[model samples]
Structure formats: structure tokens, C-alpha cells
Target chain A: MTGRHPLVGALSAVALTFLLGPILLVVGVAFTAGDTIEFPPRGLSLRWFAQALSYGPFLEALRTSLLVAMAGTVLALALGLPVALALGRGGARSRGAIGTLFTLPVVVPELVLGYALFQILMVTFRVSAFGALLAGHTVLLLPYAVRVTGSSLAQADRSLEEAARGLGAGGWATFTRVTLPVIAPGVAAACVLSLVTSFNNVPLSLLLNGPGTTTLPVAMLHHVEFAFDPLVAAVCTLLLVLAVAVMLVTERLAGFTDVFARQEADRWRP
Target chain B: MWRRRTTGLLLAPGLAVLALVFLYPVAVTLVAAPAGVDDGGLADRLGALAADEHIWRAAARTVRVAALVTALCLLLGLPVGFLISRSPPRRRAVLLALAVFPLLLSTVVRTYSWLVILGRTGLLSRALTGLGLTERPTQLLYTETAVVIGLTQLFTPLVIITAYGAFAHVHPDLEAAARGLGASAGSAFRRVALPLALPGVLVGATLVFAGAVTAFTTPLLLGGTRTPTLATLLYDYANVTVDWSSAAAVALVMTVVVLAAGALAARVPAKAAPS
Candidate 1:
């Protein structure tokens, strides 16, 4: 906490320069509808935003991205919940190994995952966007749901579940009535995280999201091939604001520590 | 054994789902190695990697960039983390969120943002020209430098978040104790504080290395044709040329290398930070 060294200050300054400076500068330049990526604003206009909005290709890509993200989140939640239950309650001997399997997507690079998925869907299954892109996203999102639900499960008052079972509420009813309520915060956190993750994901989406089904990030990839405008900055800024807003809301509701703690405890919980 | 069908039922479906969706992609990729362009077998892909120098060189470039990116992240993140932890609790949330900001933006967006700033007619170039810093715009956007910049921006948050956790764990009392013995403030911190923080720094560096090495968008866009990281190479194989065999080989190597390095780093003992 104590300020003492100039080396630390210099590094902070340089890091911020690389981090915040470019985005701010790009946002500033977007107002310049100067027919190119001009530095000193020739003039300010909303024409680019309008142009970008009306651009059929870009809008379609955006729609594709939203739809894919929505589908991916649902599938991931459906799949991940059981893993959370198993890992969150499994015997100690196998928990660590299962935890490793559940979290591998977060650590493994997207390029590697995407390439692998491409080979499988194309060569193995002969599946296209639906089988490839949707599955790839579902893969990416499993860990988030597992982490969220597992943490909440670990934090839930175990005695309450035991009490419910003792009263013959039965396992299904108790899970829905008791366990599910306790973990709602974690579930919410996972849902938002999964959606944002699906939205921003590029590498995996690029590989798997094919013809007539390009996601937003992949669309931006295609768009940048032909044009350079503030629209990219505008879209990025919007995504950034949305992400920060989600994290703020989720962290306030569920607590950031709880998210990771749940992940960790679920791993260690016998 | 408590024979609860409900528990078994609850766990079965989710595990099966993850195995089908998440685990299958990685599993299939590994399993893909045995097959060739013609017949699909492990011998064919391994032979391709062994025969091709292009793959080796691209991988080497990826490793170099990854190393530099990880090194830069640790160098930059440690201080920001220390400073944030030092600040009062009221401002911590904002600072932390700022650190995590770039992670949320799609890589393509971040790359385009740089495409504007680092371009010849881009904002930074214009500013440099006006300031009389150079005769003309220097090549930055389509080079290694730009890729590094984008990556450092994109992944350093992992370092900050991890380093902050490490920094937070070293109780202030430990530093106070060292200072009580009349050790200079710098010496006490260097000896007492940094050792404790090394693990977090290590974890952060590993994550950054993995992410940057396998980065696709920045190198794909900002790197131009000149820069060929492993991701770009893999992209060329699967998407551009439809060379599934070679692409699988390259991806498998990347996976082994990253996994080995991470698992090794996590276990290495040199990370001792003394109290």
C-alpha cells in the first residue's frame, strides 16, 4: 500500500498507456467520417453508426452472434448442472480428476479447441454450424455454470437439505425447493458470464461458425477486412460497458469471492 | 453405499452432457491425430510435422511471443496489483473492474481498435507526425509489436487478478516485523513481500503465456501476412486450406506444450516467497 518506488509508477503508466490509450483514441477518431482512419478529426458525424447499422452483413452477423450465444448458454447450463451436482457431491477419491475435466476449457487455448472441434464436426460427424458452433460454445460455458452452481451448492446450509430429507420431502422436491433456491445467485452469475463469454468469443466462433451463420465477432473480422471506422470502436465500447455492468451487478448480488470459492470448494468437497 | 437414485440421476445427466459437449471436442482433436489426409492415422500427421519446417518456425515464433507477453504481463501487473491493494476499499471495485475490462471485449474489436490507432493514417501516427517525432508513420500495426500490445492489453488482467491475490495474502505484519529489525524498507519488501507474491505472479504468467501464444484475432488481423503465430498457422490449415491433418498435428503440439508448461510451473518449487 505504501508508495515508494519509481519503477512501479513507470510500469503502471506504460501499462495504462497501452491498455486505455488506444481505445480512447479510437473512440475519438470514430467521429471523423473522413473517408479513412484519420487522426485529427476532420469532422464529427453519426453517419458511420448509421452506415454500420444499415449494413446488412454486419447486422446479420450480430443477429447470428446473439442467437448462437443464447443457444450455447442454455445447452451449457443444462449439461453443466449435472457435473456440478456430481462434482459438488461426489466422493473425495475422484473429485479432483473430475474437477480438472470440468475446468479444462478455461485453460486450453481457443485456437486449439476450435481446431479440434472443426476436425470433429467436419471429418467425424459431418456437422456444420449447429453441431460445431453451438457445441463449441456449450463446451466453453460448462465451467462457468459448474463453478457458479458448485460454489453456491457448497455454501448452502447443508443442515437445511438434511432437514428436508429427514421430513420425507424426497430428493427431487428438496433439490427444487431447497438446494435450487440457495444456488440461484450462482446460477444468475453463471448465466450472465456464459452469455458474455459467448458474445465476445472469437477464436472458437471463427473456426466453427460457418457460412450464413457468422457470429458478431467473426462478422467484425470480415468487416475489418474491407473497412476501418469508429463503428468497431462503438460496438466494442458498448460490449465493454455491458460486461462491466454485468460483473458489477453479479458481484454485488453473489460476491466475486463466492464464485471462485465455489469452484475451489466444489473441487475439494468430498 | 447410500442408494439414492435421485443423486445418481442428478449427477448422471450433467456429467454426460459435459463429456459430450466440452470433453468431446478436445478428445476428438487428440483422436484426430491418428488419421491422415488420405486414410487418417497418427503416422501421417506426425510425419507431416516432422517434415515441415514452416510449422516448427511458426511454433517457435508463438513461443517467443508467448514468453515475452508473459514476461511483460508480470513486469507490469505486479505493481498495479500492489497499488490497487494499497488503495482504500471504496475504490477497489472500480480499479478491479478497469483491470478486467479488456477481457470482456472481443479480440476482433480490440484488434480493430488497434487497427485504427496503429495504422499509417491512424490516430497515433497522426499525433506522431504532428509532434515531429518521425518523418512518416512507422510500421507497427501489422508487425509483432502490435500483436504483443494487443495481447498484453487483452490478458494482463489475469496477472493483476492473480498477483493481487498473492499480494493480499502476505500479511502487513510480516513486512512490519522485517522493518522492526531496522532492515531498509526496500530490502524488507524484496525479501519478505515478493517471495509470497511469486506464486500468484507465476500463475498469472502461465495463463498469459497460454492465451497469447494461442491468440488468433490480433495476429490474424494486426499481424498481417508477415507474422505467423501458431494460431494463425492452425487457421491457415483448417479454414484456409482445409488441411485437417496438418492442423490437428499443430494443435496437438500446442496443447501438449501449454499443458506441460502449466502443470510444471504449478509444481515447481523455486516460487518460494519468504516471510
Candidate 2:
């Protein structure tokens, strides 16, 4: 088949070329000296990077994004860890319903969900505290935690917990002493992804942010709506790099199998 | 047993949060959409929604795009899925890694990537001009085509992975069995192999279909203000119009549509699927 059907080889190369070309093009434009968004950028300069770094809103938004993402990831973990444990302990009917609830953050359109949360916060509770916004992000963020943690727990070796309990560990102690360490990798992967998701989320952040709480993504969204700037490219480039890097690290850690598995990659050919 | 209470207790927070963030907002919208401007019956908002041709148009546009996107995902994804699965195991792993990398890349980055390449002054424009296909850079951005391109690129990998998984799981023994009985390679793949992989194909279609409809960022960024999908339409009401009640109505509509598609997808039989 190798020689008789050279089309396979040609096809693979063409697909790779298609997928890789745009990514490289964006990276190339970031280095271009042009003021407007031009690709095959005429000249190479780092001016945009300098400007992106110095721009006040861009800087502030970066800071806010990092803080919120960190806070969101941690809060998601704190809130969702228990839920994952509960899933392990719960009845079948309840677990399914509970899962539907938890993964709402993933499936729901961010705008509607965030707007709903915004309304509840402002109109119903009158709680416009940044803390409440943080809570909203956390609530949304937790579903990933529940998903990742629940999956890791589901795939975990029950024999390990049984072995620990047989050694006289209490249920709580067994989870802490045996279960947590084994599942820590999944938790870590989830946290990293959680941070990225919340960090890059624009719609929810737009609805939720107050005077000083705008994240980088929301800031970029606003900046684009008003006018274009090269700094947007610089910011986008940095975020893209960061995202690609996160993915590389995560894939390395998790072996691309888990993420692929969840997405149902196993059905493909040999 | 500690398990019963603990499981119930553990499930409580996630479920409660869902009620708060998900179900309640939906409930608020349902209860309040009809109750607009105080003490009114279902006449005001319901009448507007029922009468509005724009709503129907937007919905039809959304469904049309979603169907197209899923179709593209299936068409582009299946062969790619088969190709990736056939790679030498080591390179296969690497290719799979490259494939899923986009899934991890934030929707923002992916959208921006397309914007850079597909924009008027972008590389794609330059490339097209260089090839003498156009006198100047063609208008590729802010069109329904661009939206499809972005979404197809985004969701295609999931389809590939799903389809690939099914293909991979297809027991070599079965194919071998067919071939041993004098079936050609093509016939073996078509008759014996493809039928067993129907579950994966069904799963892939379901995922891509659901994913395409619910997707927001790519369409918003790529399609801009011109082509509005249901998610985008709902966003417009919620944010631009500042009408949560109407937005909720729209969101509920989207939820029901997506859920129906999902249910329809689920009913697709595995082994009896059309090749």
C-alpha cells in the first residue's frame, strides 16, 4: 500500500501543512513592524511587544487575568473536590443529575450563564462584591474540577483504597493518605486547564467584571470593539504561546490519552 | 454506611451550584419572560417572540450553520482520523498530540489564529493574490464561510478522534476473517469492519453536532456582527440589548434545540448505519 497508494502520504502532509500554516502565520505577523494587522509583515520589530508591555490597560488586564484565573482555579478545586468524592459515594440517579449540574459551565453558552449570574448577583442578592464575581467564576470553574477529579477517581485503582482501609485507615484517612496522592496528577492537569479556561473566558468576564476586575480576555474584547491596535496582536501572541505551552505540558504529563479518551478518540483505526 | 451520606453530601455542592448557576437562571427567564412590565399575562413578550420573523430567521440560520459545520466535521474528520490511526505507533502518538493541541488552545487563540490568516490583509489573502486567483486580497473575513471554516477546524478533531477510536477498536481479526473468505480489502473494510465501528461514528456525529451549536467564541469572533447563530443571538440580547428576560427565552430555545438534536443523535442505531 505504501508505494501503490502514495496518496496517503501526500494527504497526511497536506493536512499538516494546512493546520500548521495559520499558526506560523500569526506568529510571523506578531514580529512584523507594521502598525495595522498585516500578514507577511513588511519588516521585523519588537515595538509591538514593547507597547503591549507598557500599555496600561493591557498590563492591568494581564494582572487581573492572572489573579482571577489563579483564584478561580483554586476556588474550583476547593468547591469541586468534595463533589467528586460525593459522586464516588452517591446513588446512580443522583450522580447523573449532579453531573448534569456540574458540567453546566462547559456546555452552557458563557454569555447566558454569566448574564444569569450577573443578574442574580446584582438584582436578587444585590451582592456586587468582587468576591461574588470570584464566586461566580469559581462556580463555573468547578465543573471542570468535578469532571477531571471524578474521571481520575473513576479510573483509580480501588484496590489501593481497599488496601489502605485493610491497613486500618479510616475512610477520610484513606482518601487523604492513599487516594489524593494518586489522583494529584489529574487534579494538577485539571487545575492548569481550569486556570486557562477562566483566564481566557471573555463573555463571562465581560458580564462579571467591575471597575478594576477586568481580565485580559475581556479587555481584549473591549479593545477590539472600539478600534484595532498592534498591541492586540502582541497580547494575542503571548496568550497563544502561553496556551500552546500549557497544552504541551499537559499533554506531556497526561500522555494525551486521557484528554483524547474523554473526547472519544479511542474509536479510530489501528 | 459512611458512603451513603458521604456520597449524598459530596454530590450536594455541585448539584446545588448547578441549580443556582444553571436551572435558576432558566427558571427566572421562563417565569419572568411572560411577566414582563408587571401584572401582564403572557401577551407582551410571548406575542413579540411569536410574531418576530427575525427570531425565526436567526434560528434557521443557526441550525443551518450547525448542520453544515457537523457535516464538514464528518467529511474532513473521518479520513484524517483513519490516516492518523494508521501512522507508525511512535509518530501516531505525536500526531495525536498535535491534533488535540487545538482543543486545549483557548477558543480565543484559535479564533484569533483564523482572523490572522483569513483577514483581508492576512497571509491567506496574500497567498491567494500570489497565486493570481484574485487581483487584490479578497474579502474572506466576516462571512458565513469564515464561521464555518473556524468551527469546522475547531470541532473536526473531536470527530476524528471519535471516529478514529472506533476504527482502532475494530478487531483486526474481524477484518482478517472477512479477507480470508475472499473479500477484497475494500469489501472487508466496508462490510465487516465499518459496521463494527458504527458506534464511534455515531458518537462522533453527536459530539460534533452538539459542540457546533453550543459554540460561541469562534462564531462571534469569526462571524463578527454579520452572521448571528443562536448562541450569538442570545449573546446580543443578554449583553448588547441588556435584556436578560429575552436572552433567557433565546437561551432556553437554544437549550431545547440542542437537547433535541442530542436525543435524535442518540437514537441512531450502530450496526445499521449507512456507509
Best by TM-score: 1
Model 2 lDDT per residue over A78-170, tens place: 878888877764555556766666665655556666766766665566666465567667876777787787778888998998999899999
**Residue A46 error for model 2, in Å?**
1.5
Per-candidate fnat, comma-separated: 0.51, 0.36
* DockQ versus reference, model 1: 0.50
- Model 1 misplacement above 4 A: A1-10, A90-93, A255-270, B1-4, B22-25, B31-39, B269-275
State the lDDT at A74 in candidate 2. Answer: 88
TM of chain B, each: 0.90, 0.86
Per-model CA lDDT versus the true structure: 0.73, 0.71
DockQ of each: 0.50, 0.42
Residue lDDT tens for model 1, B1-275: 55344446666766776676557767766654424335264676788889988899989888888888888888788777776665667666666666666665677766777787788877678778889999888668888888887788777777777777777787877877888988776776688888877766676677778778778888888887688888898888878887777887788778877887777766762545443
TM-score of each: 0.92, 0.88
